[model samples]
Target: MMKKTNYSYIGIAFIILVFGILFVPKIVDRISNNDITRKESRSDQKLKNKALKQSDLVFIENTNNGENRRVPAFSFVNQYGKQVTNKDYEGKVYVIEFFFTTCPTICPRMNNNLVQIQNTFEDFEDFGVASFTINPEYDTQEVLKNYASTYDITNPNWHLLTGDKAAIYKLANEGFYIYAAENSAIEGGFEHSGNFALIDKNGFIRSRKDAFGNPIIYYRGITSEEEGTDDNGEVEQISILKEDIKKLLNE
Candidate 1:
């Protein structure tokens, strides 16, 4: 009986030890997974809040220009035979994009997305969209008018602008911090990229974003380009660009 009791005690001890070894690992794994999940949740929340934090600043400093200059003004025309200057649209929301009617690729997709923007803000009288033709010489008012018609872009708030090549190039380089180089072979105008310059009601350039990703500002045009091998690339991507625009509009 003594020996049997001793054996029984030994068996109980072994069982307890095995159970503890198995249970501890699962407990530890559960803690580690929970910690990781918590961290990720916090990170996502931070990005959400950052996107919501808009700015009231009128102007943002740009470094793309050779002189690291601020955009002061631009002189261009709308398709309706009206002259437009940067000063004309003070305290109104607008967007400016670069393109020619003859772009063989990318521009079409960008414009299709832009149409969604045009329709979205058509009712907002204070908002407008402007597209400037890099090939101003060929993109006559008539050409722009026809193009606008094809897209059903009849919003009075929208403007398809064309002007002298020299002035447009200057505006592209100096005013908007965009590069519109004159390439002989490309049809509609110059070799330009796809970018959108977002300006606020205060005549200040607040944000520059891509043609497709951002919300359209019923006031301007859009542009696109392939800078490098298309692997997670962001060319002239403005930091806090969207937030800055929102801030200006809200203010």
Candidate 2:
């Protein structure tokens, strides 16, 4: 009777050992995966906070935070010949770029990249692109429409706006902090910064450093060499612009 009791105890211990060997690895795997997810979440939060801290951007006081920049007022006409103004963009996030309809180099590259941006964020109703024509006389509403058609741009949210030369130039220089000048020597007879800005719904420009390391809320345009690279390896300034927009949207 004592020997039979001892054998029973040994049998029970062997069963428990086999069970642990089969299920322990699965439980451990689940725990490891959970830890990785938590780490990724923390990393994302850190990046968002870092971007918000850059002094290059202006901010507005709000219920959540007391810092943001306010965009100045403006009146312009879109490609469809409809008037566009500040009220139209009251609750929208958009990027503004200066480009001419006809250009030999940079403008074409810039505009093409913008098309990609438009497609990438097409599903976002609150976001859009604003391509302002520096050559107002040549890039009239009709000309802009023609240009839009060639690019197969059917999205009305992407506005190609035109207004008084002085007013437009004022916005470009003082408001957008970009360089735009009438240079006959340039291929397009006009020259402007290759950069574009990501504006929040409240119109605060996103922050990035300028060439001089000044606090600027604009991304420099694709130029002669070495800069932002996208996932597919096509070099363009739009990649940086795209990432910045995503970060703002997530916030």
The candidate maximizing TM-score is 2
lDDT of each: 0.66, 0.76
Off by over 4 Å in 2: 1-68, 208-216, 223-236
- Candidate 1 minimal-lDDT segment of 10 residues: 217-226
| TM-score result, candidate 1 | 0.59
After superposition, candidate 1 runs with Cα above 4 Å error? 1-58, 62-71, 185-189, 208-247
lDDT tens digits by residue: candidate 1, 1-251: 99999999999999999998999888888778887778888999998886676553434555554332334676777877888777766767776777888887656755765676667566667777778788887889888888888888867867888888888888887777666787777664357766677777766666433456443322222332222223444332322333444455565
lDDT of 2 by residue, 1-251 (tens): 99999999999999999988999887788678887778888999999897875433434333345555456688899989999987687677788888888877688767777777788888888778888898898889999999999987766678999989999999888776778889998676888888877787667776655568655556655531234564467465556677777666655
lDDT, candidate 2, at 119: 84
Going through the candidates in the order shown, the clash numbers are 22, 7
TM-scores, all models, native as reference: 0.59, 0.66
